[model samples]
Target: MKIMIDAGHGPDTPGKRVPDDSMREYEFNSSTARRVVAALNDYKDVQVEITFEDTRDVPLKERTNKANAWEADLFVSIHANAVGDYWDDNVGGIETYVYLYPGTVAPKLAAIIQSKLIAYTGLRDRGVKQEDFHVLRETVMPAILCECGFMSNHHEADLLKADSYRQKSADAIVDGIAEFYGLSKDSPDLVPGNGNQTIDKGWWRKAMNLTIEQWRELAAELNRMYQDSVSGKIIPPVLNDYRWVEKAYKTEMTPEELLTVMSIIQMRRIV
Candidate 1:
């Protein structure tokens, strides 16, 4: 599924910062958005597009237009909330929003995100709300905007600045989306030469006499080979065999190619 992630506002956007000016809203938003993209990559059959930049504030119309043009399945806008650009110890919590007239799918998406955020962050549940935000209203797909915490609140501001909190927030958002769509993590099953058979993890340990760490190292090497193959730094042996075939393709390597690369790597290890 195609997902669009928007980091709300920009570095230069006026007044979207902590009262002490220690942190910008875009810093938190963009950081969390990036983490969300990386986390989502672990899921199979998922594609993500980020709609905002670090340098400039992208207009809401442009952000929604890009999602619409890409025909994205879902759109998520990430932001840090504030009230009146001043510090307040009392105002803090997590909230998520859908369009005022959100359709069936958007409300469900918003609820899932809201619940996950509160669960993971241990933040107060501000609950799901409806707003006529430009991104939510203009995007054709199901879209939701998340207000992670109030920048106006000093306590929440500190949490937003921490890497651990950003990571947890990103994970919660990805988990929510995955739950809604029933996404599975990429697994060895995506590898080609196993004849669609599920490999038992225990069997790999017994047959290869390799610890879990060793298996992970091997997988990491295979992943490097796949990256090299994709970048044209090196042609995977399997690809040379299919050079004569013509087919439409995405920028990402296909499952068959990835599987064949793994097979070749495994054979080399045995030899």
Candidate 2:
């Protein structure tokens, strides 16, 4: 499945940022998009594309239009939350948001995202919420704006700043997306660099971040399950990274590649 990733605001917006002024919502959103995009690439059956890239200020309407244009399966806008109504020195938690809709998929997605975010980061769960935000209210598909962690809170602000946390947060979102919808992980087109014939045949088109791996040769560090699977050697551990091939997408995976990708995903054991 193809999904649209929108970083809430541009770099120069002077938008939401941490209290100490170190991090901004744009930074957090963009970085999480990148991490999620990178992490999801293993499935080979999914494809992810950012609505707008590099300094391009895609308006809220334009972002939704892009998703509509692509008929994207889901629309995810990432952001960091503010501290409080009065700016007290304390406050922190994870909140997943959707527009006001009764018994809609948005709320379900929000709840799953909220739970996974809490589980992955050990952050406080503010719970799923409904708000009439422009992006949330206007998007046609299942749309959710994740205020991943509170930039206002001292501990969460610092914690959200870490790449490890950001990566894990992105992974949690991807996993939630996969489970919520009955999307498949099969990718019949993924090629193992079999040659130009395989490349021209175009089996790897769905993946956004799919690329030739760095260490083409199997390393000893690779799990026995993957080595065994390649030759009926052993059963692979789910989401072991070394066992999974990164697909470069954030939406959903095809059925054919699902089990293989899960075996290769290193972070599968995370959440």
Candidate 3:
């Protein structure tokens, strides 16, 4: 079967950047496309056709046109996630999207890719979602978009730079495709030039590591504290202790201290 691998965004889109300003989304997405193509190429039974060879000049519509013309069995658009203004690149994680009301295999294909991305990347699973995407909506086959990690997040930006991640990312994409189309080891649909199609049993272990509900609770609590401090609604014990307030950065100073002592120290003079 033929597969169209579209590395989303073209040469026109410089795409997003990292905190250290080291990694670019265009570079990451393009590199991932290459890795995916190579892996699929290894399977002679599959013909991996890439739509975005030179992202610098490739137009989004043109890429979609290529996929439609190819009559591919599936189309996977690889991309990284980015949010907010350039000054604060913070929100990120893997969110694989399928067209809002896609064809029969759209949901199934997205599920296959989304599960594998979290399993191998060790990143937060943003879950499989629906987006009114132009490419996925117009494409003739099952499609998915992978937002690998957040470019705004400082820690994840560092992780994306590692060389090993590229290979693993490619493996995840390839393995997922193989599994989705009933192309298991016994299937003749398996990629050619391989004796056995290895399954990643370790996926379960990685999946058990991250849970979104836990983080959501943590964020909720943090916001609640900030709100309480603003409204003077916090516990009196914490507010009364000058040192504790300072530790939490909620209050100004020790009430017991004389005005003379407080006036003596200027805001500029104090750390």
Candidate 4:
């Protein structure tokens, strides 16, 4: 499959920097886009190309033109979001967008990317949305525009700048594409862990050092939290706290923290 990856915006675009003016959106987008292309290239029979090869801002029309010319099977646009005119450290999450049309291939692709991104990055799910984004509307094939996280949020901005977080983002995209195509280890040139594992089992075993039974118990605790939230026993503030939980920052997690997060997600589900 041929995939077109568009790293949104150009390096010279004004006022697209992180809250501290430390990094440009293009810097994060381009770096992550390149990593995603590299990961997808590791798979067999997959061809990936970036919409813009350099830091220069290519017009939206030209970007779509190239994808259409290549006859790409999928188009993925990577971006970092800013909610307001000013920085807001508290606002953050992962969201994916498809064109504002029903029953399109874009929504499916967006949903796949959104779920994997939430699972791998441990970000709050802003959910899949319908938007009239140029990249989503103009692409000829299955297309999705992924807002990795809000750069205005300090914690998320730090993650966006980290190489480890970028790799995780790329890995999620690759996993989504592989799942959509049903690519497996047996496929020519396919890489390992392609839909074979959902969560990072190795990371869990190595970092958390928990046994299978312990993990199950933790999951059960999360379920109980969800039940409580649904029953309206948990107040709004407590619900909000658990709704935006993040535990996999750089894959560092204490057992207590992990359990808290697991419980939070469970609560989020029922609310």
TM-score against truth, every candidate: 0.71, 0.67, 0.64, 0.67
Q: Considering every candidate listed, which one attains the maximal TM-score?
A: 1
Cα lDDT of model 3 by residue, 57-147, tens digit:
4777888899999898888988766674353444667888988562367787788888898899888888999888888888877888878
Error of 2 at 120 (Å): 0.5
TM-score, prediction 2: 0.67
| Residue 215 displacement (Å), model 4 | 42
Supply the TM-score for candidate 1.
Answer: 0.71
163: Cα error in model 4, Å: 0.5
Model 4 TM = 0.67
Stretch of 10 with least lDDT, candidate 3: 242-251
For model 4, give the RMSD to the true fold: 13.5
Ordered from best to worst lDDT, the candidate numbers read 1, 4, 2, 3
The candidate that achieves the highest lDDT relative to the unseen native structure: 1
For all candidates in order, the CA lDDT equals 0.75, 0.64, 0.61, 0.72
lDDT per residue, candidate 2, 26-125, as tens digits? 7777767765655444444566667755475678888888888888878888888885423444677778888866656878877887788889888778
Could you report the Cα RMSD, in angstroms, for every candidate shown? 12.0, 9.6, 21.5, 13.5
For model 2, where is the 10-residue window of minimal lDDT? 214-223
Per-residue error for 150 in candidate 4, Å, reads 0.7
